[model samples]
Target: MSSSYQALKPARPDLDSAGLPYSPDYGDIYHAAQGSLAQARHVFLAGNSLPGRWAGRERFVVCETGFGLGGNFLALWQAWRADPSRCRRLHVVSLEAHPFTREGLLAMWRASLAPELQDLAAQLHAQWPDPLPGLHRLEFEGGALTLTLGFGQALELAPRLEARVDAYFFDGFSPARNPEMWSPHLFRRLARMAAPDATLATWCSAGHVRRAMEDAGFLVERKPGLHGKRHMVAGVRRTLRTPGKARLPQAHGGPRTALVIGGGPAGAGMAHALALRGWQVTVVDPMAVRDGGVHQGHTAAACVPLIARDDNPRARLARAGNLRTWARWSALAGDAAPLRCGALQMQRLEGRAGDPRDALAALDFPADWVRWMEQDEASECAGLHLSQGGVYFASGMLVRPPQLLGALLAFPGIRHVQASVAALRHGTDGWQAQDAAGQVLAVGAVLIMTSAVASWPLLQQTGLPADAAPRLATVQATGGAIASWPSGRLAGGPSCVLGAEGYVLPALAGRCVLGSTYEEDKTTWTQTARRLAIAEKMPAMLADAGLATTDGAEDWWGGDWAGWRALVPGRLPVLGPVPQLPDAWVATAFGSRGFSWAALAGDVVAASLEGEPLPLERDLLEAIRP
Candidate 1:
């Protein structure tokens, strides 16, 4: 399947005299006039025997075909919140071809009689995704509730979803109006995704729909309809036959403790991902501080997505990682959140064949994802003068690494241990991490080495053949430094991040970050060289922004310069398990792309441990496998 997503242009809904939402395209009311919330409880919640069915379960997943006005989701969320015996985690996956705009949803919610649902409706409105044709996962209530909204045609989306649905809310427009949603192909796809004894509830009891369900191995039965409807259908998957093809890998069902040997982006990301899945994760780093020591001194970093002519694995992984990072960080509150002001990749030379804009145009990506801008347009967007125009990423973020790390480690069940792991030992139970003093720092069911190049030495100390993974031998620790200019030094810095050979972030806290010069042999960086390097590119970027550099600007480097080491080889991170060790994984070699790769790589680690669906395709996973 194509990874690109298109934005949906939804037709506005018209309300009847009773204020019931009516769909002009489908020629059907969104819900019964009796009351949408009431209809949801009777036709969906009670039809599938939910609340009671989900009781005491570790996690329960519910799939809905239509999410008109999000009434069903809100009602279900309310029920889960009220039930004392509700499942520990509630995952609601809903598909909608024409999702309502935020204003539309809010207006519908305001017209409702149930005041209890208003608050939940507001929350949903706040978290509503960009109507992009892909699965958008939004988490709420501290990860207790997750809503995976698939914005696209049901036929195209249902088959791509990786979910083990326990119950289904099959509420679509009348089968006569939108037959594709109730087709045999969709039914069979649903069957393939259903878990054993999966139950489905639908208000439409059309004979053809019932027959399709039966043919797909569901035992269907007519039931009392909600409101004044003549009939509704409820069915459960029959276990007599095979449970269809497996949806995805099952969870490991092993111990839920993990030890991550780094406190940088990769380790913090892994800890956060695992913690969200109810794992207790401990991150060890000798330099870690409670107040964001990991990224101290560095005020800002660019979080731009990469573009490639071929859209190779590196580009694909970077794109996926960028999206995941945005979602994960946007859900965070306070200073931990990243600034979402877009970023610009300035064109280096005239008519460059490898320009990102040409590649993006060839790919025909959604405008919201990326768009080409001329120098004039780029200047207008950045609120500055510019030398060249290139591609603009609307979702690019400006993240303070330390703040982000602090936020990732702040999640409950994530402990930050201040110690250096000198060695690792894998035994029958799991893996043990020891400090230089031979003190056991942590023992976990799984071990993730995120210490960058330092991990190779630790692996060698554990008697694990580091050479077993030939790629490990190529890992090199390269050092780099980022210099900054005081905000006053430049005549109003660019409004957003600007990238060419080197990148500059919009001024943050009185300083504009610049110059990330990489050197293989140098562990330290001088202010003079870093300043000159930044100055060389500043004129081109500033000239377009209509800003002129003043005398001595090249020597006026701010105090925000700092050096750090990044592991690299092929510029692709080494992820997944070690070649010969089970339950031991490595997430390193991210190099400068740590922010761009951390979230997705961390999810891969968490998914592998949980035996859950991988966030990446198998081929892409193999490209970075350790």
Candidate 2:
């Protein structure tokens, strides 16, 4: 049945006079209302027996129905952070139909939670997106914890999402008050996204809700509810096999091997995907250490598409790249390294109806999942000023590039060696890559998944300016930079990944990061005045997003800010097999779009090496070339 008839609002125990969300002051509510926070802990946390249930797993995911004030998430983060044996990573995904303003969230967090959760609270507030329908992802603590806020009707949003949750927090106000949340369809969708052993806890034990859970293949039961309430409902998910559970074939070539250079998202993703296919993979980098590496050798980046939404080459590649990269990254990092927090791109705050942002919003993708927002809603979500609205990617994320690389490199078939390969030569038997010391680092079929460094004249002989192949499109590099600041005061950051000119991460390690500048290939990573000029323009891009530059902000080294390039004419990255080189392949020209394209690129390369069907068309693959 359609969920269009759900109630817009019902009397909530936590709200005060004039419908302002508030509750009776308790110990945790001294600075704010305690109803929502206390109820969440009792119904969602204690009911699920969290911290104790997720003790042994490598990763754990929890899905909730509401993320109001983020009190529940803060408590969970705090609990997970405090637990010595907590899973290596914790993922929290929540859905909300109407989100609060960033300032309101901060005020509530400050009033309710203890000082310890304040840092995380502030970070959440800082990156909160505009109230556009979709998802927003946030990362914290070196990619150990992730928060995905789904903005839209839970019924409409739940089914569109993918990911396995270890626990469920049925946290919408009340079934009687908010009946839409207690629908059978949502329960079934929840079961679908849950693993066999998934557990759930909810404050309401209403007969209708309990029946729906049971109908949705959950082993529902009743327990004591909070605040002297009569009962609560809890359950475990039932398992159903997906269409294909078959095993994948191993690579046939003798001791199949892939060589990944340049140690960034592309290299890391390539290594990881190949390893999964049982291909022996080795990654070489010039500066990264084999152990105790500084800066972790990677940073988080995005996979956003250009504003225009059409069937052009860039749009198609962006769409394909977005889907492929998102799937692989989600599989590896799940809720840890990144959260599929959808994205929003606005034009001017006061833009007209026919604005670019509005046009993008009209794409026939998923109306309920992503739609245009009015200026007020945009202003509310971003906690800043806004002009015209923009498009929202229901499926988007902000990922820790290094953390993902670390996971990708951790695959069993992959090995890490510290050395720089100066050149490559192919013999009658096979191919050999030589390091500066002239020692043979590798001998087998090699794929040069390195950045532009390998595109230099040294390896230009393999195939060059003459045989660069006919280009379906041309692209140029644009310099970009990301700066960071401690977000100690913000609250309830965006519910989705929000980008305009440059983007801002919700917060990592209590610090928020904003980026970047797209410059013509200048070939320097330095953060120069020109780069900062682009960086400083974020305020205007997010005019409705009320963020001010921090004092003494940490100037992250935006390496060589010169080489930051994005393919011009068409903004898509060049991917797939190298046309000329038989034993070699190249995955380059992924300028600012690397984060969104690399995962998919890695998958496509792995498929190509394994002789599997690629996910893209041949013409599209051959579109981006030298």
Query: Pick by TM-score: which candidate is best?
Result: 1
**lDDT by candidate, in order shown:** 0.78, 0.61
Which lDDT tens digits does candidate 2 get at residues 448-496?
A: 5455435444446544453453331244456555655444433534555
Which residue window of length 10 is worst by lDDT in model 1?
1-10
Worst 10 residues of 2 by lDDT: 25-34
* Model 1 Cα lDDT, one tens digit per residue, 391-421: 8989888888878888888889998889877
The per-residue C-alpha lDDT of model 2 at residue 562 equals 26
lDDT of 1: 0.78
RMSD of each: 4.2, 13.4
lDDT of 1 at 353: 57
Q: Estimate each model's TM-score.
A: 0.84, 0.54
